[model samples]
Target: MTILLYDLVGRDTARPFSPHCWKAAMALAHKGLDISTVPTRFLEVPTVEGGVSKLVPVIRDGEKVVADSFAIALYLDEAYPERPTLFSGDGGKAMARFIERWSQLTIHPYVTTAAIMDLHAMQDEANAAYFRQNREQRFGKRLEEVMAARDAGLGAFRASLEPLRSTLAYQPFIGGQSPLFADYIVFGALQWARIASPFRLLDDSDVVAQWFERCLDLHDGLGRKVAAAAAAAA
Candidate 1:
């Protein structure tokens, strides 16, 4: 079956900036599944797949429809066991849930907070206002106010990634010899920032940067091609 992935896109459709959407994309890639993507704008997502999901990364695999990146990851893993494993075992699966939560609660906030302005710039006027209003409500402050501490923001964000840095220093990926859903959980956020902003999250000498480069090379350079290709235009 040809899977259809409704991917969240900004003004530039080539830059699918939603970390959640990228997670689904990478999962589908890991499963060796061929997918056709529809570039969806923020305001357009509420009607995706006939309003079944008010989110992007919603996938339709033949007659089955799935929403939420993590749910879709599990679905791909189970449905195509012969392709390759997303999770190594039950323990790995459980570990992935923890990683997902950590990425959401910790890493995602820093990345989004730092790149709020960059994200705002990528949207058209209508979408930008919509984004500003919604995010301001969430942050209880204006976008400029939220991103005012960007200098300190980068330090804090990098510090939050210490555990991952320490781990990657010893192993090539969170999955040791191979990349796993846990790896993708964090990579998705990294890719999000990469696409939405010119801010460099990791230092050139950082071990995490090295690992990130490895991830950039995976699936025939799928992750790198998606966002970095749009960097010039952005």
Candidate 2:
């Protein structure tokens, strides 16, 4: 059965570098799994008839509809056990869960906020159109209200980054040498944020930046591909 991944075109989600979807995509790519990507815009209702709420990064493996990124990762793990293991052992499993949760609960908001602010700055017309359409589809409220909420959300996001900064300062990866789900989760969020906002989150931190580069190298040379493509386009 072919693995079908529902993704966003040009990374339109809250974070431009969606670590959640990236984690799933990276896992599949790392395993060299035969997969097809179906890019969709944010909040676009899925054509599949199911009970799932509207969300991007849904995976369809034959008749099965796997929603949510973490759930999709679990499904991939179960379906293809021969690939590099995500959870090495009980301790590793625990760390994986913690990292996933931390990325979602803490890192996601600030990164997303930064991205939105960046978009507004760089592409005001396109960003405003996107914001209007997305707010109407997802929030079903006036644009003003959505903007207000986004402001509050950004503040909350800044507060959330404090713990992550402290934690990352100590360890090279979330686990140490080898990166597990934690490293990927954090990387994904930060990657998306950097792509969208071009922020300096890792600029001053040598260890974290090096670790991030190492992770990219391990995962099929994504950074290389990006650089090559940019150079070619230039």
Candidate 3:
């Protein structure tokens, strides 16, 4: 049976911009599983699979419905042992956990500030209003005000990626030779920024940017299929 992925999108259903959704999508691709995506808007998320979760990146495989991108990846790996492994073993799983936390703590805040308004712009009017209000309440500032400081934080953001840069210098991927779930974890984060914002988050000469380009070319250009906001507009 084809997996049914409830992927988050904004006004453009073709653009599934949620980082978590991208993680699940990439994991499914890595596992060589067939999938059909259900483009879910913010407001429509609560209605998916009868309120499976407050968040998206939900997948239904046969009779088993799974929520959360990490859980979905775990499920896919266990269920399809014959297919390509997401985490090569227990050690990889442990490393993936660390990388996930590092990406969230070190990478997410910067990208959120950099792309929050662009994310709002992609939403429909209703969702945009909700996003603006909710995010403003969370951040204690308007979306524009939040994004305005992105330029100042750019250097710190780049510096925070030194560990990843060091790793990429030694190997082509986070998974060494082959891309793994760890690669997808970071890829999903940057891919969110790429799809939502025109901001240049990384310098062209940065190894992190080069690594991302390599990731974009994986799964037969899966990440590249959704053009960046600037490219999409062009």
Candidate 4:
């Protein structure tokens, strides 16, 4: 049976942009599992799968229901031992934990700022209102004001990726020759940026950007299935 993934989207349901949801999607692909996605929006999250969790990236497999990207990944690895392993082993699991935190801290904030307004634009009226109000309160400023700082934040964001860039210089993927859950953890962040905004997050010359291109080609261009926001508009 194909697992059902509750993937978060905006007005364009074809584009699933949530980083967490991307992680789950990539994990499903990595495990070689057949899956279908239910396009969910911000307002619909509460009602997904009978309100399983406050957040999305929910998956229903057979009689089982799982939420959260990391939890879903763990479930897939355990349930389908015959399939490709997401973490590979206990050591890989620990490494994935670290990478997840690093990506959240070092990458997410900048991407959030850069893409916030565009993301809001992608929402329907009701969702846009909710997004603007909630985010303004969270940042204690208007969305435009928050986005203004993204230009300044870009340098820091690029510099912060030095560790990842250096690692990629030596290996094709964070998982060595092939991608593991660790790769997906970081890939999810960039994929979120790619889908949400037209602003170029990385320079063409940067190894990180090159690595991202390769990732987009994975699983028969799974990431490429959803065009970058700019490309979609063009």
List the lowest-lDDT window of 10 residues for candidate 2. 225-234
Candidate 4 global lDDT: 0.93
Whole-model alpha-carbon lDDT for candidate 2: 0.61
Residues 44-87 of candidate 2 have per-residue lDDT tens digits of 43553353646667778888888777677677777778886666
Give me the displacement of residue 151 in model 3, in angstroms.
0.7
TM-scores for every predicted model: 0.95, 0.71, 0.97, 0.97
Per-model root-mean-square deviation over C-alphas? 1.9, 5.5, 1.4, 1.4
Q: For model 3, how does the per-residue alpha-carbon lDDT over 7-39 read when each residue is reduced to its tens digit?
A: 999999999999999999999999988999999
Candidate 2 backbone overlaps, count: 1
lDDT (10s digit) by residue, model 4, range 132-225: 9989999999999999999998898899999999998899999888999999999999999999988999999999999999989999999999
Off by over 4 Å in 1: 227-234
Of 1 and 3, which scores higher on TM-score? 3
lDDT at residue 181 of model 1 (Cα atoms): 88
Instruction: Record all residue pairs in model 3 with backbone atoms less than 3 Å apart, i.e. clashing.
Output: none
Q: Tens digit of lDDT per residue, candidate 1, span 87-145?
A: 99999999999999999998888888778998998888888888999999999999998
Q: What is the lDDT for 204 in model 3?
A: 94
Instruction: Write the number of the candidate with greater TM-score, choosing between 2 and 3.
Output: 3
